[model samples]
Target: MRKKLIEAIKAAFLSEGYGFFQGFADKIQGSELTLPALWLTPIEVAGMSGRNDGKVTYKIVLYLFVQNEQYDEQQKEEKWEELERIARKGIATLPMISDVISTDKVTIKPDEFAFTSFGELSQTVTFLADVYFCNE
Candidate 1:
């Protein structure tokens, strides 16, 4: 699962012409920066109450470790927003699993973002997708 998620991310980056995986050989070379190890932290999932009504939603958190000094606060924020957009776009392209299940982006904090799923199959697919994309 992690492999798939990673692969998907790498593919997305490559598709966007970043080529970080291919250019550096052993490092991640962003368009305006570079890093030795751009660590993608473990993925996490949780269930929470929904806003529309009395319901539950599944949330998945995926983390990426950009070196502390690589980018300034403003740059980091901009990069985060870009990455979030990319992630959301990628998830939107995935086929629907069930009528009741839906996904959306959630903000955990200034530096943390989550892709949330609502409904019965939400947890299962979200977990599988996180692993799949992160690992592939």
Candidate 2:
């Protein structure tokens, strides 16, 4: 189930012509991030109920980076909007996974101070993927 979710996310971002990575190191260095990238962090997994047939949910946070060559506020906001659209499109597929039963809405927050030194704008997108499975 985790693998499915991860693949879906990668496809979603990759379809939009951006790079996808699985950690914080590249995102923080700014210099390391290839502009127009999504950094994925699988935060936690928790069983939704005690019953064996119950659902299990996982939390994921995606860090989106887009280049802002001149550090223009208008361009930054536009990039944020674009990233939000891509995030929503990705979240919409959670229910399509065979084991996935539901998903929370995508929550996006702009990091105004993030990676400014490298002329990049960043945003954080968070969502929950809930699935019903006997074993993960």
> Which candidate should be chosen as best, given TM-score against the real structure?
2
Span of 10 residues, lowest total lDDT, candidate 1? 116-125
- Any residue pairs clashing in model 2, and if so which? none
**Model 2 bad stretches (over 4 Å):** 24-27
Model 2 worst lDDT run, 10 consecutive residues:
23-32
**Residue 119 in model 2: shift from native, Å?**
2.5
Report how far off residue 125 is in candidate 2 (Å): 0.4
Query: What TM-score fits each model?
Result: 0.34, 0.81
- Per-residue alpha-carbon lDDT of candidate 2 for residues 59-114, written as tens digits (9 for 90 to 100): 88888888776746787778788878877777776566345677785589998676
* lDDT of all predictions: 0.37, 0.74
123: Cα error in model 2, Å: 0.8
Clashes of each: 18, 0
